[model samples]
Target: MSTRRTLLAGSTAALGLAAGAAHAAPSVTAPQPAAAPGGRPPNLVVVLADDLGYGELGAYGQKLIATPRLDGFPAEGLQFTDAYSTAAVCAPSRGSLLTGLHAGHATVRANPSSGARVP
Candidate 1:
């Protein structure tokens, strides 16, 4: 209905599709190095919901919003209670995340969703 809900729904659907595809698709990308006693490396799933508070999910402590799927992550996987971000906005923060550089050292200090090189 609303813009926020629409965006969230779309993002949620994309996430589900990506997860399903990763599991169903054949391994035709790369020859990953074997891990000790483990064939492949562990998969890391990062969900960055813009403007979502830490307590918004049921995993945390939100009574209003029912997030059963997300709540299960703590038991099945990892749940980070605290996290640090270089930027408050998504684009800049994600830029720093992918580059592993703090906001001060990163070139994309602002939201540049165009994926264009900044000079």
Candidate 2:
């Protein structure tokens, strides 16, 4: 992975996408937090970018890096435009994204330098 570290991990790999989850930290001006009123269970932020590619950000359009808070996660979280990763490295794609099992039945399939210990 070296076209200058894949353009420096696709230019410092960032995808914020934390919009209005009760506007605690994801602020555009703060004060728009009222929706979880019925059963409640929505707020989620699960961004994991190792090599970084999914149109490289700006909420998957990426017009030369602006990414206004990762373009506010498809208007507030949950955007998986045809996702696919079960190991291009990163310890078997984080052990099949924490144990769903894909990267050869997962469990740290690689990325252990030369010691590689996870028996």
lDDT (tens digit, per residue) of candidate 2 on 28-47: 44333346767564464567
Model 2: weakest 10-residue lDDT segment is: 11-20
Q: Kindly provide the TM-score of model 1 when superposed on the true structure, using C-alpha atoms.
A: 0.54
- Candidate 1 Cα outliers beyond 4 Å, as residue runs: 1-40, 111-119
Question: What residue pairs clash in candidate 1, if any at all?
Answer: none
The lDDT values for all models are: 0.71, 0.63
Compute the lDDT for candidate 2. 0.63
What tens digits encode model 1's per-residue C-alpha lDDT throughout 24-49?
A: 75742333334746666555467867
Per-candidate clashes come to 0, 0
